[model samples]
Target: MKTTLTSLVAALVLAGCASVGTVDPAQLPQAPAAYKAQSANGAAALTASWWQPFADPVLDDLVARAMAANTSVQAAANRLAQARAALGGAEASRLPQVGLAAGAGRSSTPGQPVPQPATQYNAGLSLAYELDLGGRLLHERNAAALDVLSREQLLADARLLVQANVARGYLALRALDAEREIVRGTVAAYGETLSLTEKRARAGDVADLDLARVRAELAANEAEALALDRRRLELETALAVLLGEPASNFRLAPTAWATALPAVPAGLPSELLQRRPDLAAARSQLQAAQARVGVAQAAWWPSLSLTAQGGGVSNELSNLLRSGAGTWGVGLLAALPIFDGGRREAGVNTAKAQLDGSAIAFREQFLLALKDVEDQLGALTLLQQQGEANARAVSAASQALKLSDTRYRNGLVSQLELLDARRSELANKRAALQVRSAQYQATVGLIRALGGGWSSDAGVKLAGV
Candidate 1:
């Protein structure tokens, strides 16, 4: 009987080892040439901490706050802890489980010691171990470890989001500041023009209609400037909210007009697949799901367990460990799932379906990421050209506006013509400012889509924030 049981346990163990399903490591997607934004390999210099490249102190401050205070980041950290705890728990199953028992009781038996009650005491240690013949525990451990990896990727994704948001918010604030300055200049110019028009009307040189028109234009410009200022304030408050700070406490200093756009690197699309944190998260999840298939398949096999216990029983407390009062036993158990209402089968199918779904999800994310990089790359290229052209237009308009004002002062141009020149100059400046802002933001977006700026080949690890 002993030999048969040992053979049965060994056979079951071997069967478990053979039952694991196979899963292939996913390959990176094809890199598209369209994803490249520049001719130089400058993007290769991108680090996960690419936000630091801007060297903006105010931006850095806001990023620090977002990293520390963002609820999403904290939540990812909690998930990592949970995964680590689960891994610890899964590992515990690899070792034997030990327990202790103790009892003292009084018992009476018929015709025993002239019907006297007898006192008894007992103590023992018990141990049980499930032989890992089916590798179920091993697969479970692997899955749990992968879960930990997935959580780590999630944390990275969270950091990326925080940094991107900070960059965008800072960019928006700066853009609004530029727009407000342009509007203010227009308001001041309109005020001067209105004053001149009123003086001419009083001297009977210009008609009242002309003066009324100039006053109306001045009021309109002032109103527009006020509206622009309100919008700027609202953007400031929104950015502050994202930093998890009171809006009043967060202040963004207005920056001068930015003339240059950051350079983007042209890298292979395949490289992007390895750079994105969300993609990494998806890959890790897929790996975990594949491992779960093995865990589930392991359930179809018999399980082997070994147990042993040794203890002493004695009527007298002092003789508990005496040779005559001591006893020991060892046993091995094999459990074959003969019937369980098809629950095991259902579990296996569920795990397989989940694995399939995970694979599909990974592919979908990869494709979407590729699309994002391509779209941003195209936008960055076009916005840079547009910014250059707009700058030239602004310079020409500035010269024209100066000539128009001089001509008007010398009585060579009408008040309506001066107003037209002023409006044209203001519109050109506003357009140029807007184009530059778009260029800045588009550069930031391309960098973000490329996975926080670092390639897979770089050994640099992006710290949180």
Candidate 2:
């Protein structure tokens, strides 16, 4: 009866000891149900190869090359492999460690006229296991497993970033190409205007000052065209670096302006939460930190280790395995912390602090994701409106230039008026192209905000955490 009471008391004490730190995820802030942009029922779904929707074969090829050769992508893959190996190591702690040992040695006595000689041989297998009665080993394994998931998700995130960057670079290149064409056209028009003005001056129909102004305009246009060429070359070199090639060895064909941007679907909140690798990584890190807390708390409890060894020994190496010349033993040891200069307590405190830090980080990530989605949605909407406005402006500017040229031929407008109209028309056309470029960039930003072409099923398969 007394023994039963003692067991009950011990069980109650251990139960009290087990409840140290607690974290309730429900207490954390929740993510919004949907992004600011609402899609129609026919909204397109996001694909892993999202950049392909632009239909730029060059961009498609570039993304493929970057995935295969980019240094950052390779580094993320290596990190994932390392995480997997570390998780395996953590799991190994749960099983018994067994080893075999064999040895032979001879000893002699000193300070004797006739030396006393002895020989010994031994061979045995030793087994040791630390019983995880409090689930410390399992918790540590759980933490390591979560770390592996975080790393794999991080790898996915890295790939997504590379794809988005390639798409952006491709779009910028095309936008610059359009601008260059506009500048070249302006240069040609200005050269014609300068010739007309010089011919009029030589005939005494216009003053020499008019010819000088036209020539100055021609020089300015030529300089602008040269600047555009420099910018385009710089973009080309940047793209080559992204593709892991030398700048001199890489080239891109002219940009494809006719390609349509890919439309993305508005997935349900549940799917979005699961698809965003960064969010998943944050959650995994939190779980890992939680497990670490348990591991730290377990340090306060006594540890039980079981060790056993059985082997044969003989005076001669030949009889090392003989049954009669054998020795065997087993040990059950318990270790309780006596004194460690406050190291263990400090560890526990550090783990608790880390748990708090992880919780804050997870919440911060969710907030940032929400903000990104909203910002991109607003940006896409405004960019589309701006693109339409730019188109109308380009059309009006073209009409004004045509009318001005006709007026100049009829002697109703000055040559300067014609020149101004032509320059305005050229600037307006380039601005229109910039609007289209902005729309493409906005689409890319929205895709990135939505977590970059992830599939729920794929996320589940690749990141089982």
Weakest 10 consecutive residues, lDDT, candidate 1? 456-465
lDDT, residue 332, candidate 1: 98
lDDT per residue as tens, model 1, 6-29: 886676456455544444544434
TM-score of each: 0.87, 0.91
In terms of lDDT, the best-performing candidate is 2
Model 2 clash pairs are: none
Q: What is the lDDT of residue 351 in candidate 1?
A: 89
* lDDT measured at residue 334 in model 2 versus the true structure, 0 to 100: 87
Name the TM-score of candidate 1.
0.87
Q: 366-440, model 2: which lDDT tens digit per residue?
A: 788777676766776777778888889889999999999898767788988988898889888988888788878
